[model samples]
Target: MIELPTLYHLATPDAWDAEASDDYTVSTLGRSLAEEGFIHLSLARQVSGVAEAFYAGRDVILLALDPHRLSARVEFEQVPGVDDAFPHLYGPIPRAAILSATPVPFAQDGAHDFTGLLPEPL
Candidate 1:
């Protein structure tokens, strides 16, 4: 199977702090995992859309995760009417899985831009 070099997860400051701990076994989506049964994630190409839909005007840190380092299973599933499949983590994302954490940049109009957050396309 082909592996994506990186995946993105938009997280709050608290979540970022929690994930920084060695004991942090769960990813930032603890509540989502328990309630929705999976942690929501996005591909590099889908980042902007997801951010606009859910994280607009909010201060969020983008998590750059290495799928290879993830202890939990990562699946790419399609959403209704969406052309591309999105990455979903079946379990909590271990901190080690996160290669880097950077604040999502915003444009003058208050729109979030996800460009340059990841390395070259996979």
Candidate 2:
């Protein structure tokens, strides 16, 4: 399988805009990095499901992050009943790791649709 160079982070616009520093250091809100110890992430195919379940009608942004540039350790962990593992970054993220930030589009039914936002498969 071909591995993409980047991964996606689903974030609130206010959280990203307010907290992301000029130096590229960012703290993810809701993920509770200090308490849970990691920031949640989803693969291209996984974004839709995650949005539907967690974010739903809330406005969110899809952040494109270069995995290689992240200061934290990213791990793909299996959750109960889920077939595929999800990516989790075990530390604060840096702005330099982010390649782009795009608003997550809403479907006619008012759910986040990540179709065009995700990177094409490499």
lDDT of each: 0.74, 0.76
Off by over 4 Å in 2: 1-4, 22-29, 120-122
What's the CA error at residue 3 for candidate 1, in Å? 3.5
Every model's TM-score? 0.82, 0.83
Scanning candidate 2 in windows of ten residues, the lowest lDDT window is 22-31
Best by lDDT: 2
Clashing pairs for predicted structure model 2, backbone only: 24-95
Give candidate 2's whole-model lDDT.
0.76
Prediction 2 TM-score vs. true: 0.83
